[model samples]
Target: MNTKAEQTKGASAGDIGKLTLAAVILVAVIVAYTWLGNGNVPQPVRLIGLLVGLVVALAIGAFTGPGRRVRNYIAESQFEMRKVVWPTREETIKTTAIIIAVTIVLSLLLGLIDLILKSVILDWLLKLG
Candidate 1:
């Protein structure tokens, strides 16, 4: 019997192959659409090509067992992502303010040191001249 990890690996490989094939097919479709037309391809045909490619690619993932697993994996991942506890707007603003304040303070301190060093260097240069 195959372990869970092995099954997952096999499914991932199949998904990757399907995606690569889809990308190749999409590129071919785009090239034909562009070259076959006089100037730019019509908007409707382009949209139809995109929709067709999407449907075909998605079908590739649904028709096989590995494809079903890939779909399930995607759905589960989306569900898990929705459960994440994201930072609130207030927290984000507070973090941004703190970062800006620290940056300003450090910039002022560095500017003061740079001015003092420049004055000393100029004085030494004048004495040498």
Candidate 2:
């Protein structure tokens, strides 16, 4: 029995050509968008062309092995996301409030320490000079 890795072949020249074609199409889309000036083509028309070109290029790319892997990864991520037990709005708010309160208290403590250091260094040490 062939393992999943063994079942898959290395990228052939055809795959490279298809990926290159997709890249060329993407570049063409950018060129076409800019080449058609706003004075010649309406902004909406250019935008529509861009969207269509992007979709076509992406569609071509999605058939490739890497693209299929990306799709699988995204699907897995979405599936895993469904299993997450997200905190409620009340819990989030309370957590945020506690964090803010702690941060403020920490800041006050640090500021007091800094003030004491400055007083000791500048007031005491500098006066001796």
Q: Give the winner by TM-score.
A: 2
Q: Under the 3 Å rule for N, CA and C atoms, how many clashes does model 1 have?
A: 0
| Cα distance off (Å), candidate 1, residue 36 | 3.7
Q: What would the TM-scores of all predictions be?
A: 0.58, 0.84
lDDT of 2 by residue, 63-97 (tens): 88777877877887888889899999999999999
Candidate lDDT scores, in order, read 0.76, 0.88
| Alpha-carbon deviation at 105 in model 1, angstroms | 1.8
Error of 1 at 64 (Å): 6.0
How many clashes (backbone N, Cα, C below 3 Å) per candidate?
0, 0
Q: For candidate 1, lDDT tens digit of each residue in 10-101? A: 44566677767876877777786677576666878877886787778667657666667767778878888898999999999999999999
TM-score between candidate 2 and the true structure: 0.84
